[model samples]
Target: MQNYTKFGKNININNIEIAVKTRLGQPHETMRNGVMKERKKPGLKKARKASQFSKR
Candidate 1:
């Protein structure tokens, strides 16, 4: 069988089974990564980060 572990292809079936059992089968959550990125706010520099200000 193909190696599902991220380590390498030298892994055995037992190790693969254990990895699957432990829920480490695949690294990526889904086929498309970062598809649901948070939208930046209208006023904020970033999504939630605002510009820094200082009082003289």
Candidate 2:
């Protein structure tokens, strides 16, 4: 038997139980720590993008 804490809740798993085989999957790292947006750089159209060039 094993104990797991998920979403602030306690869960128990038995070696001989089918629930053990269908255990929950872990959340993504970003999800666990919260997602953050990248800051845009100076003198750029976007974060890492620039204006298009025109050659005539």
Candidate 3:
């Protein structure tokens, strides 16, 4: 893939500021959102409850 419009040349991206306001970063938020979504899905609760019974 061509990085620039003229030809296939690597572009300099040295000034990129990589961070988030909180310490955990955006990835943590995304993962937390996914878990929350899965918990809300149908049949998920039943499966989890079944696992709890096996731990007894």
Q: In terms of lDDT, which candidate is strongest? A: 1
Collision pairs in model 3: none
lDDT of 1 by residue, 27-56 (tens): 322213423223344677643453343321
lDDT of each: 0.41, 0.33, 0.35
Please report, as a residue range, the 10-residue window in candidate 2 with the lowest summed lDDT.
27-36
Candidate 2 error regions (>4 Å):
1-34, 46-50, 53-56
Cα deviation in Å at residue 55, candidate 2?
7.0
What tens digits encode model 3's per-residue C-alpha lDDT throughout 1-56?
Answer: 22233211331232111222122223222224223111254588789999999998
Show the colliding residue pairs in model 2.
none
Clashes of 3: 0
Error of 3 at 27 (Å): 20
Q: Which segments of model 3 are wrong by more than 4 Å?
A: 1-39
Q: Give me the displacement of residue 11 in model 1, in angstroms.
A: 4.8
In candidate 1, which residue ranges exceed 4 Å CA deviation?
Answer: 1-11, 24-56
Candidate 2 TM-score, C-alpha based = 0.19
Q: Per-residue lDDT for 24 in model 1?
A: 46
